[model samples]
Target: MGDNTLALAGGNDKKWSDITSQESTDINTPVSFADTKVKNVIGYDNNTETNVRVATIEDYENLRDATNREFAYGVLYGDGATETMESIEDVYEYYRIENGGRGYPESNRGMRGCFVFNTENGNNLFFPIGATGYGQRRTEHAWYGETQLGAGRLQYAWRNEEYKKKDELGYRPLFLDVYRRPGAIYWVRTIPTNPTNKNKKYCFLDINYFTFDFSPGETEPTLGTGTSACFIRCVEEIP
Candidate 1:
């Protein structure tokens, strides 16, 4: 009758014996369960059969709500390939379904809304700017280019000499893993406060050949062709 105890149903002697012998725990020992509800817990990689302490969509949203920055996650098309705004919306909608179908609202605790970056980030950012989302607009109009670099995400991926713990990166002022291919170029919305060209509206971060390079005056944003995708993981003021 215990939560972790699974009683053998009507099964043959051999199969039941095999399953129970390995999975069964001592009733008297009292197995320790997760502190929170199993469903509430994050970082469960079923494939790996281990908990990966990577940031979930909820983590991204929490970071966004607390700090007004948009934690964009997607593959930006750069190399000659092009996609429209509608396509991006489709991709985002698919992403929502994949990440647990619009998780319980932080305020309501269970109400689900078609929450978008505009709703969380508090800006009508999904407008026609060729492609991309509201983070670009918010970065341009407000925040004034105070976004964190993509390298900021990697800071938590491993335990370095400075950060002995993996979770330690989460405590930093701004932590995000706008994960993408190493060689692919990614977009950074921070418009140069003093750009060489005043007409340029967007800037980009190039992560290729094991080097981090920032390029100003990117009139057009692209994430290459095929599976090469870009992510927009930035930081904002912690509200």
Candidate 2:
């Protein structure tokens, strides 16, 4: 018989409809079909049929291997890059071009330079070394702060003092060549509770130090003044 064809008892050829006919006798007990194999089991959910399969040992191994793999630092990522980063100079050159030649002495510190690090969940997170002035946290409202920054994990770390000691959090440089200067001020995605003037205070990080204000040294930036703006590094996940 052909692989696609089926034969029933007494050597009679039968179609799928013939086998499932209402007149057919029902077999309640388990009946094994010889030489039958299936890659996935059929199931139903929410009135919908689905194909379900358990993970094989190879699947688990592949996941473990992917999780354990380390990311090569200074590697060029994103669209149309052909080479791997070979040196710190290469990283700096890439940074300069991306930053429009703005460097440390400029107000755009760390804004344009891109770096990547791996997370515990095996995601490659790409982020800038500096903050951007475009999406400045305009309100001191804590909820607004969290929603605007869109970095809940980072905000939690900043509030709980996790960044100071946790190297895996990506606040500190994972690779030696990835430059992040000490004492550089950056904004956190949180606004602390201050019943006195909640609208005036916003949180920021001075690398190892943490505080709230409109600017680094000042109590608050003049409302409508852009001085409250600080580097806001948003993270992107690479597939």
Candidate 3:
């Protein structure tokens, strides 16, 4: 069963036929992104204003330690109840162009600049890497288990050249979420081992106290991976 979306093998397809042939799926079963909503919903965006509750380094660290998953801030302008789009570019734009480049008030960061301050030491911070487009297409194709470059057809705003310049100057910021409902599946930055594989990865924060990954279970048993319309929720980091 290949991923029909990219006309390539799916993740599950490869899972059954292991390269090492050891059936390693059970080796390290991934834990879901834990569900721990920090009370960082700072404010509501009327137009382009970012309204995220700032989390201290302690706050975030505590959350990560407790859940084993990092916290994702909310980009407040999009329709939280639904997905931005099926295409990665469209989803990225929802936060970049539509959300005013995540432009927030200086008060949020005490005039230094927008940042996810590392509360542990209280001296470190990071900028948003951009909304990762887990959706990928083969810019070129190769056999299974081989390395191939696939253009995800998406670009993160933080990776933009201008943003890079600003980052050099220290005006860096971080990223966040989509979906209004607690248990609804939303997009996060992730994909399976093979880019050409169609069984794309998605995420959700269950109200039951854990965050988990999801994907299209099975394709048509066809030769290629399956592509389905999905949702988007951005992520940010330091390293």
**For this target, which candidate reaches the highest lDDT against the unseen true structure?**
2
Per-residue CA lDDT of candidate 2, range 1-239, in tens?
11233544344775322233111122222122122223321221134333333322233224335544443322233232455544544333332232332222221112322232345655653323322212232222122123322221112121222233455445444322211222233553333433455443334433321211112211232222122334543222223
Where is model 1 more than 4 Å wrong at Cα?
A: 1-182, 190-194, 210-217, 221-229
Q: Judged by TM-score relative to the true structure, which candidate is superior, 1 or 2?
A: 2
Model 1 TM: 0.21
Model 1, position 78: C-alpha lDDT score: 20
Best-to-worst ranking by TM-score: 2, 1, 3
Is candidate 1 or 3 superior in TM-score?
1
lDDT values, one for every candidate: 0.27, 0.30, 0.27
lDDT of 1 by residue, 1-239 (tens): 11222323232233211232111133223222122212322333332223223222333324335544432323332222344334434332222112453332222111111122543547622111112221221111111132332221222111112333567466433223222212223344333323354554443333231222222224321221111123443332233
RMSD of each candidate relative to the true structure: 23.1, 25.2, 19.7
Candidate 1 residue 236 Cα shift, in angstroms, is 3.9
| TM per candidate | 0.21, 0.25, 0.19
- In model 2, the runs with Cα more than 4 Å from the true position are 1-76, 85-90, 93-120, 130-185, 194-202, 205-228, 233-239
